[model samples]
Target: MNDTVVPGRGDKGLLRNRVVEVENLTIRFGDFTAVDGVSFSVRKGEIFGFLGANGAGKTTTIRMLCGLLAPTSGVVRVGGLDFDDGGNGIKSIVGYMSQKFTLYDDLTVGENLDFAAGLRKLPAAAAEKRRAELFGMTGFDRPLTAKVSDLPGGIKQELALAAAMLHDPEIVFLDEPTSGVSPAARARFWGLIRRITAVGKTVIVTTHYMDEAEQCGRIALMRAGRIIALGSPDELKDSAFPGPMAEVDFQGSDPAAPIERLRKAPGLLALSPHGMRWHAAFSEGALMDAALSALPVSVRVRKIKPSLEDVFIRLAGGAQ
Candidate 1:
């Protein structure tokens, strides 16, 4: 992804009839303010991606939205229900999967499902039927008699998700659902997310992965309890780093020398090392020729699209 920042018009009524509406949400603990005056909305059936660095208030905002915590001063509405009126109604309509795997490791898969069902006050027969459906959906044919601890990481996550959604909530809040899972397992988990959205369930997820943010229908970039940027992937890229980017790699020398040289080159707006290579963004026709000409004979360079990581770095004033 290119780090180009595209200019954005203020938020419009794009999500006017929002399923989840937050207005000037703020949360504070004693003298420390966790979430500032942040406001955003999630439309029905939309996959909304919440993004931020550590301590950026992403979790605080989520907690407030889920009715797990009340904002110091702000209005929040979930599924058109007022959050402060009574949390019970809201809780019943929303499902949540925290970052930590919250299943009882000692309990069998069936037992876990049953426990969740019982908490939701589901009928015995209904809970049994739902358990079978969940197993089929997650591709877990293992006996429900097997303990949760006996399952692999991927299966554990799947079962957790199934449990969270057992009551068929209208909205699901997933807090870094793929945090510790393997790449393949992450992909499978995303598949389940798609399936949920296909059935008209709104998914509000928070993630630190730039690639994962790109998969969302729209995203909000947060910092210190405030939203720094919010828009589609392309919009944010275009606004944050409004230029072409080139990714350069060398066969011999370190990227530092080329990076420093590129910084002084004309038309090059930004240069930073990403892993073993260097990424440089340039205004159109600025340093395209000069940068290429200045590279060492042992170096190789190629132009690539800007990414979310680049945009975030630039917006945050190069603070990785």
Candidate 2:
């Protein structure tokens, strides 16, 4: 089977091994349109990502995918199951972890697990087995008696993930799973996420962190409730900045004048301030020559590859 990721439209036949397929998906609340004709398909065992700013419809689209909310219009399918059956089949094979904390803070680690398993109607022995298996997979050795309220943010998020996966769903949807956690904790959580994918399960994640989004096999960048760009990380980077790019550091000098000057330079398509420096994308070498000729001698110009943040800023950050 060909494992090509395609826009979820036109072709009626399913893409090879596609676990999730959405076609012209749109959701509206009163007059506000949350998701506007978004279409995408996900491959099996792939780490698919949804990226966007606040209210860009990442969560709203994910909610429709998880069968949490019905779409106002368009076709939706998850794990090869259509919504015609009232999403019962779709819900059975998917796990959803919301961006907000959904676990009961008053409960203990084991209690939370039990509560989640009970919701899925898992038996005592099955829940226990899955718990041990998940803990082993995640290297999570926190005591079952520990209160969730007292646990660290990282630990709590991991526990919540464990609860969501208690039923061993085929597809897992994690909405902003690593938000508001330490870098170390986020790294560790992604490690566990990698392990989950290693076992051949599909993961659909929505995250704000560029580094985390880089881990996705393909990313759908959303803006104004629509997919503005969709491709692999490298593909998106190339599409956003197809020509040579450079990072210009002012060498402790004021960048205000140089920024204004480069804005009018020939061959330069984009010039945006990134951190302490400026990233300039040009159609050719004329911009670099212009920078060297017009800018102060203290300035430093070095060629560099574009990162996912660069693409995000260019494509989804409203204006660069």
Candidate 3:
């Protein structure tokens, strides 16, 4: 279905009052190009995701957007300000939370917040007010004097996010925010993300987790420093496989034999084992039915919806 369009290839009209705009963005170090002419725009107050495996240039892109790293060539605009103009003032209106926790572990939670506020150069009175508001919203019931090093993993993540948003920036950048957290912690963290976006703050996050990618308003799948696909979760899934998908369970001695046999067929686009069953995609209509009939009658087949993982595998041409 050719879902591998360049980033922001088709959805230009839908992007109104964009909070971030990048055109022909490229970054290079010596001879290696980390980002290659990527183009995409992020809408205001929406969650934009960069979905890909490690070393796919997600962190590099985010760093460029946050003004920490300079792009070799491109047009980048954030909050109606040009990135080429040094982007010094842009730092005040944009918040960034890196993959690793950046706060001082030796200090108390309150002290960490104070340090962050100082870095932002906020006045003491304004910083106090913001601290009160953040603590209230985050339900930071732990003693402000408690050392950050002593907090639980989930609490540490929450505290990191709180520090990022202490200044109430209009735009937020979260780089792999849930890298080592548990599923329950991830869920709770995402809930916080939802509430933050609900209040009119734009969010740009990078993650390899498919479930987390599904939560974004839109996602751009990156591969080898390039965007191969971009769309909402449903749109990507629909365009990923232009055929019928089915989950099959074979009541046979060797599932491998049946899968290997099916691979040689003309209509089969992809076939892969899922536990005791197999998930396959085939050309629509007659071809699909024909492929199904070729399987042994002892097999059980049921049509199923394609998942994001399936879509990625098919688009990446790694189907098996």
Q: Give the best candidate by TM-score.
A: 2
lDDT of 3 at 172: 94
Candidate 2 error regions (>4 Å): 1-14, 290-292, 318-320
For candidate 1, the per-residue lDDT at 141 reads 75
TM for candidate 2 is 0.93
| Candidate-wise lDDT, in order | 0.83, 0.88, 0.84
Give each model's clash number: 16, 0, 1
Off by over 4 Å in 3: 1-15, 317-320
lDDT of 1 by residue, 121-182 (tens): 99999888887887788787778889999998888988999999899899999999888889
**Can you give the TM-score per candidate against the true fold?**
0.90, 0.93, 0.91
lDDT of 3 by residue, 210-265 (tens): 89988999898887788888888899988877788999898665777777887887
RMSD of 1: 5.4
Better of 1 and 2 by TM-score: 2
lDDT (C-alpha) at residue 281 in model 1 = 88
Angstrom error of the Cα, residue 241, model 2: value is 0.6
In terms of TM-score, how similar is model 1 to the real structure? Answer: 0.90
Which is the winner by lDDT between candidate 1 and candidate 3? Answer: 3
